[model samples]
Target: MEIYNNHKRLYIAALLLFLALTLYAALIPAYKAQNDNAPLPNSKPLSEQEALGKAVFVKEGCVACHTQQVRNVEMDKFWGERPSVASDYARNKRPDIWRNTANLMGSERTGPDLTNIGKRQPGKEWHLIHLFQPRSVVAQSIMPAYPWLFEIKERAAAADVTVQVPEEYRKNIKGDIVATEDALNLVAYLQSLKQVSLPDGRPVPKFLYPKQSTPDLKGMGTQTEDAGLDGASLYAANCQACHQQNGEGLPGAFPALKGSSIVTDADPKALITVIMKGYNGRVKEGFAEMPPIGVNNNLKPEEITAIINHERTSWGNNASKVTVDEVKAVLAEIGK
Candidate 1:
């Protein structure tokens, strides 16, 4: 009761309490985190090139859309083998002086999680082309292209790394699309995002979506001689993501598969090759390049045949069905 009359004493007490809370809540935790000794297995510090690439990634605001941390929830398993622990971020830090969000563990995930992008998509060529034009590989992708990070040269020099851009996409540019040092560094950083496995005794969380174990649709077998391939189901499951259910494809990004010449072609050679090895931009206008679904997605010969048949027969196209033997022969000839 007497303290109520002592304003200065009360003010001093409140200030001391605030400082104590600040120390308990912030400083202590930061100090413990900085001193953590247990890091994830096989996790390495960034190389010089990768560090530069990280700067480029931060400069480009990549963290705004792509999250680097994988949460413990089951749904987040798609991004990494296991949930990210404190040790996973131990090696990720800015210098002592620079302290603007040192951990690039972004909040919003407008783009897919980049925590394990290095494992998901590792091809240097793919990253280069995708950076040059997101639409080139993913026609419907809204990711901004960083063309300014590349240089257009009349011809590639001995040291220049050229990417596969459709002629039309490169129109009015005098030279080939070559990766700049920044671009190379940026890709290096992207490629360094593999998820490190948790140390022993830490249980890996179960996947939210159980892996499919049963045999795929009738025609989904990888064997060359297997019959009863389910073309419709296979197409629905795999191709429909980009080609659309109706086979119309996304205009300007993905070509119309329903009435496309390649789909209706009698030979079926091109279709098989496209699915197996992937196709880069060929024309000067429209239709971004198609990544090799078979290889990247691990599609077998029978699966490829089923997809070809589905595209040929569906959407009023009257092309003949392809056999597994034919697909196998093509795969052999093309050395897939």
Candidate 2:
């Protein structure tokens, strides 16, 4: 009561109280968090180019649309192998002396989470084209283009990494599109954003509220031949992103699958081989080298068969449907 009546005494008491609250509420927990969370052993620090890319990402407001975090939910599984943990971010450091390390694990996911985008879509060419015009690769994509990140050149120099923009999206532009240093760095940062593997024997966290397992729509399951797989669904999940729903791939970047000879061939070996081993021979044709989708996605024989059947039957191509047994034989022969 006396202290309350005395202004100087009351001020001293309030200051002490505030100090105690700050110590208990902030300082202590902050110290504990720093001690408890260590970077995963396999986690690598961002390289110089990747750091520049991150700065570009921040500068360009990429965090406004995209998120880096993968939540612990079954729906988020497609974005990452496992739920993201604190260790996933432990390696993050400040951008430089002038800036603090931004909490880049963004809040709103206006776009797909990039927790493991490096693994999901690793092709540099694809990223470059997508950056130039998202609609070129994904017709339904609503992402805005970053044309400022590229330059139009009358003819690309030998050292230039040219982007293969499709004709329609080119808007009658007269020159080849070359990625600027900022664009390349931004992609490097994106491509570096892979989910590191947990150290040996560490129990991985499970996604919460697991959805009832559906048919292997993405071909990452062990469905039987008679399981009534949806070939169209398979195509949409695993193939449509690059090949397009119409089977007409992005011009100058992805080859058309609509009237592909490989899809209609009597022997499915060529198609299956490409799917399994991946293909780069078409790079000379201005198309990006295809990653081994079948192997990378861990597609089962039945799932591969379904996708093959869909591609063969759809887009006005009536190639005979390949059986699951045939797919199995092909995969086995290729040692996949």
| TM-score of decoy 2 | 0.84
Best by TM-score: 2
lDDT of 1 by residue, 1-336 (tens): 777799998889899999999999999998887887566778999999998899899889999998998887756765776777778888877746755545799999998889887865655666777788877556567899999989988899988877766555666777778899999999999989887777689777654555454364455554443356688888875577456677876544456788889999989888888887777665345445665667645567777888888899999999888787788898999987
Error of 1 at 122 (Å): 1.0
Candidate 2: worst-modelled 10 consecutive residues by lDDT = 217-226
Model 2: per-residue Cα lDDT over 1-336, one tens digit each? 798789999999999999999999999997799789999998888899999999999999999989998788878877887889999988887767799755599888989889887866777888998899998777778999999999999999999999987788899999889999999999999999988889999999988998665454445454334247798888887788788889988787788889999999999999999888888888887887887778656567877898998899999999888877688888889888
Q: Whole-model lDDT, candidate 1?
A: 0.77
How many residue pairs clash in all the candidates, one count each?
A: 5, 0
Q: Which stretches of candidate 2 lie over 4 Å from their true place?
A: 6-12, 214-229, 265-286, 294-303, 324-336
